[model samples]
Target chain A: MYVAVKGGERAIDAAHAWLAEERRGDASVAELSVPQIREQLKLAVNRVMAEGSLYDPDLAALAIKQSRGDLIEAIFLIRAYRTTLPRFGGSVPIDTGAMTCDRRVSATFKDAPGGQMLGPTFDYTHRLLDFKLAAEGEVPAAAEVEAGTAQTPHIMSFLDREGLIQPETDSDTTPPDLTRTPLELPATRDLRLQALARGDEGFILGMAYSTQRGYARNHAFVAELRIGTVAVEMDIPELGFAIEIGEIDVTECETVNQFQGSKTQPPQFTRGYGLVFGMSERKAISMALVDRALRWKELGEDNLGAPAQDEEFVLYHADNIQATGFLEHIKLPHYVDFQSELELIRKLRREAEANNAAPSESAGASGGNLSGKMKEGAAE
Target chain B: MNEKTDPNAARKAWLSLLARCSAADLDALWTDAALDPDHTVLRTPEVGSVMVRGRAGAVGSAFNLGEMTVTRTSVRLASGEDGHGYVQGRDKVKATRAALIDALMQTAEADAIRAAVLTPLQAGMEQTRATRSAKATATKVDFFTMVRGED
Candidate 1:
């Protein structure tokens, strides 16, 4: 039985006081403001926003400051804060086709419609540390050119025209919200995508890497990856039509996987899609690969007993908040439970010793019997 | 003439503009315009979130992408016009001012408000977009193929 324990109030208060002082960290150093974190450390803010499933950079920055740069802890703070706000409503699906392209690239095409733009990427940069960044220095302004007037079309649409890729059917039916309801097994593609979008980036990336290593390998090619800002709109009952509520930056990845077909059907390329908040291209791409791997069952491909193919395993462990909570809870006081186990172990040892002393009297009650009893007690 | 054909279209345009305008810009514009009409808060500014949705493959069924912070409110002017504001982030004052501007846009003083507030805000928004677009445009790659000596 669990017993109520008290008397840590004063100690706990003192500990917190000391923690706050430590969090301030060398008062001589200039303090980091929330705005500075939001603006300068934007990639960190994006990760928190994507994982925390909330898109307020200021709050994410504040959480980062409070957590002293522990991203998971910052995500936890954002998640907790999210529950307090009243949800106004769901926005109408954002039109990514109309997105103002910042960085758009395709691996399948040499020159896709609205030509490849490598906006603010670090792909080609040498890994050598830029010591100049340590000191304040003025950087040159980014060069500018006249904006292109041509439309930037989705590369997959080109394949769709030739019936080369599997066509995704449009649906107006409302999707089941994972947040509103507990996640059940055999989750639909929409639900799986929702979970994976906010899933832990590192976990998803690992799962994706596993797939690339021939674990349920679906020869995936990044059809396109684009990052840009899109307007968010919602239909207002009072206004009688939809209006642009706001705009948010997002990264979208589309992967074209190897074809799947039977005797009755012609071969067509399968697809996996990922859309996430902010410029989280890595997370977005990983999500697409993992998403494709999870679709083996639906796509009529054999399940290779891969971890990524197991939807339950991926979705269950992908949430770092839940994982960290359960894992860290063990460090908390379990005095009663541990004491019971200790007493059980001592009792078993005493019984074994008694059996050893009286072996002639109880020849049938051997060390094996004592071990079996100990196992049962441990189970209890 | 466009407004006459679709009466709500103009309001929609101005509301969209107001929602995208920076809070600082709106505050400055509000003060410079020197416009303060008697108004009642039909609903006080409340900070909340709206679940943003996106389509699968940019064409298929919609799924929840995430939630974004938004502040919204409804206000009615003494002249009986009601206006609603929904702007990004948790700026309560911006929401209130936006609602006031929205209401003012429907009144006889709309042209004056448009000149003093909405026009400048639209220009600022356009300038920001143009600058980003220009920078992105500069990054466009012009791939060239090299021919072998034998070929």
Candidate 2:
């Protein structure tokens, strides 16, 4: 049994004061503002929003400042804060097809419609550090051309037209929300996507990499990866129509994977999709690969017994918040539990020593008795 | 009438414009517009969240993407128009201002409000979008094929 102990109030308050001082980090230095963090460290803010599952850049920035740039801690802060707010309602599913494209690229097609634009990418940049940035060197304004008015269609649509890829159908059924409902095994695709979208970037990246390295190998090609802003609309019951509530930046990746066909069906390419908040191309691409890997059963492909293919393993361990919470809880006061374990071990050792000292007077009887006591200690 | 001319469409456009514009910009426009329509707070300005959803493959069944922070309020102008404000982020003041502007738009002052507030907000949004889009367009690839000597 765990016993609650009190009387650290004074020490705890003092420690918190010390922590506050440490957080300030020398009064002489100019303090970091939340707006500065939001504008400058945008990628960090994005990650917090994605992982925290809350998209308020300002709040995310504040959390970052409060957590001293520890992203997971910032996410924890945002998540804890999220529980206090009332939920307004669900938005109409965002239309990515209508996204105002910032960066659009395709590996499959050489000249896809809405031509390949590598807007603000780090893809081909040399890894060498530019020391000039340390001096806060000013960057020249980017070259400009007239923005295209034509719609940039999804690359998958081309394959869909030719019947090259497996078709997907839309359903009106409301998807199961992981936030509101408990996650069950053998989760639907909707649930899986939701989990993968907010899953830890490093974990998802590793899992996606495993697939590329021939773990449940789905020969995937980046059909397209686009980063842009899409309008978020919601239908107000009183208004009788949907209105654009806000716009959010998102990165979408679609992977065309290798074909799987049975006797009755023609061989057609399968798809893996990923969409995430902000300019998170790496995470989006990784999520798509992992998503495709997990579609083994639905695609009628044999399960290769890969880690990525294990839904339970991926879903259970994907949430960093839950993982860190449980992992960090062990560091808390386990004094009572530890004391009980210590006592049991000591009792076992004492009994064994006594049995050894007794010289086996009743060798079999005493030995069995000692062994029984040891087993009892272990059980305790 | 087309979407642009429809009253509902006009409200949608203005509401969207209000939501999309920066909070600072909106505050400036709101103050300058001087649209203080006496209104009852049907719903006091409150902060909340809306679960955003996305489709798998951008074509399939929808899945919850995540939640975005939204602040909303409802107001009824003394002139007998009900207006609601739902905007992104946690600015209670902005939400109240939006609701006031929304209510004001329904009154005869819509033309003046549109000219003063909505027009400027639209221009600002367009400028931002055009600037970003132009930069992206500049990065569009211009691939060329090389001919062999034999050709």
Candidate 1 colliding pairs: none
Which 10-residue window of candidate 1 chain B scores lowest in summed lDDT?
A: B1-10
Off by over 4 Å in 2: A354-380, B1-7, B148-151
Error of 1 at A46 (Å): 0.4
TM-score of chain B of each: 0.94, 0.92
Q: What tens-digit string does per-residue lDDT give for candidate 1 at A21-59?
A: 998999999999999999999999999999999998999
Tens-digit per-residue lDDT, A77-163, candidate 2 = 988988888998888888888899999999999889989999998889998998888786678989999977767999999999999
Candidate 1, position A146, lDDT: 85
Off by over 4 Å in 1: A1-3, A358-380, B1-6, B149-151
